[model samples]
Target chain A: MKAVYKRELNSYLNNPMGYVFLGIFVLFFSVIFCYINLYSLVSSNISYTFSYMIYAMLVLMPLLTMRLMSEEKAQKTDQLLLTAPVKASSIILGKFFAAMTLVLLALVFTLPHIVILVIQGNPGFLVTLLAYIGFILYSSVYVSIGIFISSLTENQVISAVLTFAIFMGLLALEILFVPGIQSPTLYKILSGISFASRYSDFSMGVFNLTSLVYYASAAFLFLFFTVRVTEKRRWA
Target chain B: MIEISNLTKSFGKHKVLDNITFRVGEGEVLGFLGANGAGKSTTMNIITGYLSSNEGKVLINGINILEEPEKAKKLIGYLPEQPPLYLNMTVSEYLDFVYQLKGIKLNEKAEKGEKSEKQQHIEEICEMCGITGVYKRLIGNLSKGYRQRVGLAQALIGNPEVLILDEPTVGLDPVQIIEIRNLIRELGKKHTVILSSHILSEVSAICEKVIIIHNGRIAAASVTDKLIKEFQDSNRLRLTAEGDAQELVKTVSVIYGVDSVEIDETKTNSSAAEIIIRTSKDVRGPIMSRLVEKNIGVINFGLDTVSLEDIFLKYVGGESDEGSIQERAE
Candidate 1:
């Protein structure tokens, strides 16, 4: 697992994709940060910056995870991993953590905004920490879904497009279904399962345990599916 | 060092391997001879634990591959038809990654040596595979031969007891083919080797034992020389002479000990005719004397040695009739 992790991380660091991802992430983040805090002067809460960043993540996270498994399959390098004396779960987790590490590094680049806020105006430390945690958890779910889609096909473009489509669907579930459902009970269920509604609590400075478990379990379920997909390919 | 029993595999409704069984002893070089899509790679994949068999088990050095893949896989190394290489990585980095991925560990006592044991081990493998000069270069920049050598180097890491190579010399030039064949021969002295190829001379040159697979079945299996000898029992003689083609066949068919006589259409023309005679005994002197009496000048005459190509065709091109083939083998 450690060997796979190191190789995957180095693959990202050696290529231009890692820097490209960081560049786009920081670029959009700065734009959002400026408009939310500097232009409007709406509030001193940093969580507002994170809330808007989730929309940017819908397009950016796929860049990091699209080639994670699909490239291995397209290049026939998966034979090396599958034939090695390692478990399938270990290979999946190794790639998952590597992408997550890059996302965390991108999140670290946002710390300067918090510092600038502290210098000029008062900001709540606990609220900022909770918001960062919420972003990390949300990104984990996105990364897992991206990787799971990657394992399904060998074409990186298809993997990226499908992942982006799924993220968009998950984010707009309530809005897409609001007009179709007439019953109040069915409407409640649709909004309840929506990722946007669950994430709204975190952006509002509320540490909701149910939302935490929902995100963690959603991430775990996709990772488990990735493992099963790799194992099933052997039989195929 | 390896045993496979009653292996069967199917892709959807089409069966690829059917009740195949074979074994390789310690330090033996076995060759799998088959045409394209004859299930050669499938068998190798199953032995290396890369693919699962529907109704069979592979045991590598007494460890079941399906039941204990980690332990069984640790004892064997596999090189697929396409070498699984990361083009973005340098040769040294790729080897180091494979070394760690295989979970090879040096002795605790060797940890206190002058240089790190892992580095020394990888360097030694590179030297053996003749890739030391390109160690720092990226795999993408290397030539095809160098890429193949790097692939071979990765398979040699940890010095596994058994090596399974699927067409190791495919797409190489003649010189490179010979070089890789010599390398496999050298490695076979220390490890049990199983290699697959559709090239007849390659199996006859390197492998001690050969198994010919045709249409997902074991067509024949025996020691290489013994298999060739078994099919070469009936002697064939090629006689080239300046005579009428029809009259030559008529005269040769009546000779004693000659089972049949056929005009070699490819080498025969109006002036000189080449006749192939299948005989159970030496009739060279009788044929020359008879032809001299008929005023026909003998241009060339020699015994034609039956090559592995003939045997391969006899087994693969014939009908799917195992009973006749078995009787001929006996």
Candidate 2:
């Protein structure tokens, strides 16, 4: 697992994909931070920045995870991994953690904004910490989902497009369905399952255990599915 | 140290391998000979634990591949038809990654006085595969032959006991093919080697035993020299003499042990005629003396050695619809 992780991380760092992902993410992150907090609202509430960053993730997270597994398949390099004395789960987790490490690095780039907020005006430290935690958990779910989609196809473009479409579908469910539902029971269920709604608590300075478990389990479920997909392809 | 028993595999509705079984003893070089799409790659994949078989088990040093893949796979090395290389990585980095991936552990106490064990091991493999000069270069920048050598180097890492190579010399030039064949032969001295190739001469050149696969079934299997000898029981001789075509055929047909004699119409002319004689025994002495006695000037007379191509065709040509065999023969 460590070997695969090191190789994957080195691959990402050696290629242009990692730079492009980090560049696009930091570019959008700064633009959203400047426009939402510094220029227009002049508010020190960093939670709003974290809240708006989800939109950027919908477009950029696929960049990090699209080629994770699909490139291995397309290049026929998976044969080396599969035939090695390693488990399929180890390969999946190695790639997953590598991508997550890059995501964490991108998140680290956002720390300057928090520093600027602290220097320019008073900002709640606990709320900012909670927002960072929320973003990591939120990105975990999408990263796992993107990796699951990647394992399904050998084409990187197809993997990216499918992951983007699924992210859009989930976003549409949160924005269009939860508020527009007529029945209270239906609204309760939809809101319970909605990723954005669960994230709203974190953005509002509330550490919701249910939302935490929801994201954690969702990420685990998708990673488990990715492992199963790889194993099934061997049998196939 | 490899045993495969009753292995069967199918891809959906189409069966790819049917009840195939073979074994390779320690330090033996075995060749899997077959045409394209003959389930050679499928069988190798199953043995390496890269693919699962439908109804069989592969035992690597007595450990079932499917039941204990990690332990079994640790004892084997595989090189697929297309070498699985990361183009973005240099040869050194790629080899290091594989060294780690294979989880090879060396005795630290023995190697403490010398260069690190991993470095020495990798260096030896690089030298053996002749890729030491390109160690620092990216795999993408290397030539095809270098890439192939690098692939072979990776397979040699950790000094696995069994090495399974799928068409190791495919797409190489004649010189490179011979070089790789020699390398495989050298490696076969200490490792159990199983290589697949459709070329007849390659099997005869490197492998001691040959298993001919046709349409997912074992068509024939035997020691390479014995197999060729088995098919050479009947003698064939081509005779060229300066005589009338009809006179040449009639003179050779009457000799003892000569089953039949036919005039080669293509090469036959008014001056010299070519005749092919098939016999169950050597009749060169009688045919020669009789031809000399008949005042026919003997131009060429020798035993026609039956090549492995004939044996391979005799097995696979019976039911194949492919025209490649005929084209190759011509």
Off by over 4 Å in 2: B107-114, B264-272, B293-299, B318-330
Query: Residues B1-330, candidate 1, lDDT per residue (tens digit)?
Result: 899999999988777899999999999999999877788999998998889999988999989998898999899888988899999999989998998899899752445546677778888888888898999999999988888888888889999999999898877788889989999999999999999998999999999999999878899999999998887754788989987999998888887988998888999998999988988899888888888888888899888767788898888884444643453345
**Could you tell me which 10 consecutive residues in candidate 1 chain A have the lowest summed lDDT?**
A170-179
For model 1, how does the per-residue alpha-carbon lDDT over A1-236 read when each residue is reduced to its tens digit? Answer: 88898999999899999999999999999999999987786666888888889999999988999999999999888988988988889999999999999999999999999898898888888888888899999999999999999999999999999999999987776557664798999888887777777777888889999999999999999999999999898798
Q: Residue B114 lDDT in model 1?
A: 64
Question: Which parts of model 1 are misplaced by more than 4 Å?
Answer: A175-189, B107-114, B241-260, B270-272, B283-300, B318-330
Q: Please give the DockQ score of every candidate, comma-separated.
A: 0.73, 0.86
True contacts kept of 1: 0.72
TM-score of each: 0.91, 0.94
Q: Tell me the lDDT of model 2 at B145.
A: 84
Best by TM-score: 2
